[model samples]
Target: MSQGYAIELYFDPALENQVLKAWNVLARRQISTQLIEIEARPHITLLSSPSLEPLKLEGVVRAFAARQEPVPLSFFAVGSFPVDNNVLFLAPKANMALLQLHSQLCDAMRKEGVDVGEEFRPESWTPYCTVAQDVPKTRMAEGFCVLRDLKLPVTGYGVDIGLVEFPPVREVFSYVLGNPVEG
Candidate 1:
């Protein structure tokens, strides 16, 4: 059975290593990712929708990824919003580049006959990479503590994009942004 699909933003491996370090700390604290339920990776979720046909999804992703440039992102703070701010996450500061890519991708997906979900639309999206979800309120402070000294306000480029299935996310295709990183 195919897991549902989502459009996710993946960063350069170096930056991903940093985020995973924080996630490992969270897991050690006994904070469970029970809600998300997969051996999750660190990523910024751009869209989550029911599973689309693999070939169609791949074609859309290829076209979308090819025309898109790498998006620069800044993680400003650790935050939460799982069914009443219950999940803990890394919050990226909102910027025009991120917003525009989201809008464009959603539009393109819709035109390609994919029913892009409403929650992922430009009006309702809240961009974040979850660290842990479904934690007890009593442990919220502890969760934040795990990420406290993680080089906050970090800057990185979203260098890769993928279309994936959720619950147990499996990637259909991933496209690396071909733009060069500036020194």
Candidate 2:
């Protein structure tokens, strides 16, 4: 089986923490069943590639970092893919700069022999944060209702991109590219 790697765009420090807090509250209230579990960090995927040659990985990160520009993104509604058994958060508003960055990164990855799935096509893309997974239909509805009732804040800011890897059958491994910036 092929290993998975995701190049993702994330919110800045403050916003990331806030989103986490909100998600934790929602999870505690609505997610008590065994059929669903919310895992994975909050992020908007730029590309999901099966594999990258070791040498090419650094180049990919550098290419993405060089083009980095901060942009604001907002989360407004909660939604779900009932058939797929997943719950997603919706960002009712998006920044063009952020979308452009995703596009450019896709183009760059294609040039590097990465086969990004068609699902990521620009026109079909819907920017969202994944809040829960393996959600049954009943829980999905309940979760959506919970999010709908809450006045979720719209968090926004510029954030650095990250590369996450899953080696073989093990769980995901993540690396934050570039030097750490002082707060």
Candidate 3:
């Protein structure tokens, strides 16, 4: 657990709660509790890099956040990174608005001398909010079964953006976007 940092887009509470529900189910069943243990809120990581400097990047994130509108997202499918550690996630429907937002954020970071690398670049990014991580290979199907019980297509807007440092997660900064959270 290295002290890595990320710029994340957080959901409005409604959407956040829905994502939490998936996490809760997995935890209750002993399937996965990685996010719960880390106390991570439901967020789509916009960019991640260890080279991030919180003090210098605050203004960059705030200014970039101010320039943007809330990005509408529909988590229409459930999937995972086909990687060794086994991550399960809710896949947001990729739309031009989301891609452009990611591109602009990356461009802003580059201007500040932070290269977010190829994985986060708009052309290669697959936008998903993680639900469970580090499940055993044999239990992957059980995790999927629990997630399938979730309502498909959790729809909402990403309303806030922030920077967090983690191992033990900590919020460095956050700014609500142009479209505010609706009750």
Candidate 4:
């Protein structure tokens, strides 16, 4: 019964729909991954912490959201970690704006005493939208085919910061990014 929150970037509705379609196709092909809950939405995780109170976590996200605006992110490639061939993902190209936001949020969370772990820190994080997880090694080639043909241009803005509970991974609340200059 472990619980935690993740700060994630969500895609536009149209792009989201397409990504869902791909996930369905892969599942139908018998290459489903873990964490395939139907309620889970497509997102890129920016930060996660296993030890923060929900109400306080909400405040942290609110303060972090105030300093950001919708950020344009390009999904330019597909990549997988060799250490864990079980997962496949869409990689977002490097953008200074996105990186800075991640850094700022991580810093803010740390300042507030959230023990954001090492992997999620800006320096060690790899920005990606996971398409599948827990893939069987025997199905690796089949998964690769799905990824190869899954290529499509995806460009959109991450317009809101959402706090998602893990395990079941449900959205608790969302804060639309607003201009910091107005704050």
TM per prediction: 0.88, 0.78, 0.94, 0.88
Candidate 3, which segments miss by more than 4 Å at Cα?
Answer: 179-183
In terms of lDDT, the best-performing candidate is: 3
Compared with the true structure, the alpha-carbon lDDT of candidate 3 equals 0.90
- Model 3 lDDT tens row, 95-149: 9888888999999998999987788988888788999999989989999999998
lDDT of 4 by residue, 107-152 (tens): 8888888877889888898898888887888887787788778656
lDDT of 2 by residue, 34-90 (tens): 212324456777777677554566656665665465667777666666456565565
**Consecutive 10-residue window with the lowest summed lDDT within model 2:** 168-177
lDDT of 3 at 46: 90
How does model 1 score by TM-score? Answer: 0.88
**Between 2 and 3, whose TM-score is larger?**
3
Which sequence of candidate numbers ranks them by TM-score, best first?
3, 4, 1, 2
lDDT of 2 at 136: 60
Checking candidate 4 for backbone clashes, the offending pairs are none
Model 4 clashing-pair count: 0
The RMSD (Cα, Å) of candidate 1 is: 3.9
The local distance difference test score of model 1 is: 0.79
Model 1: CA > 4 A from native: 33-37, 82-85, 179-183
lDDT per residue (tens digit) for residues 1-183 in model 1 = 665777899987777877887777777778765533576667898888676776777767776787788888888899876586578889988899989988998898888877777788899988998877778888998888877778897778888888777666677778877633333
lDDT of 1 at 157: 81
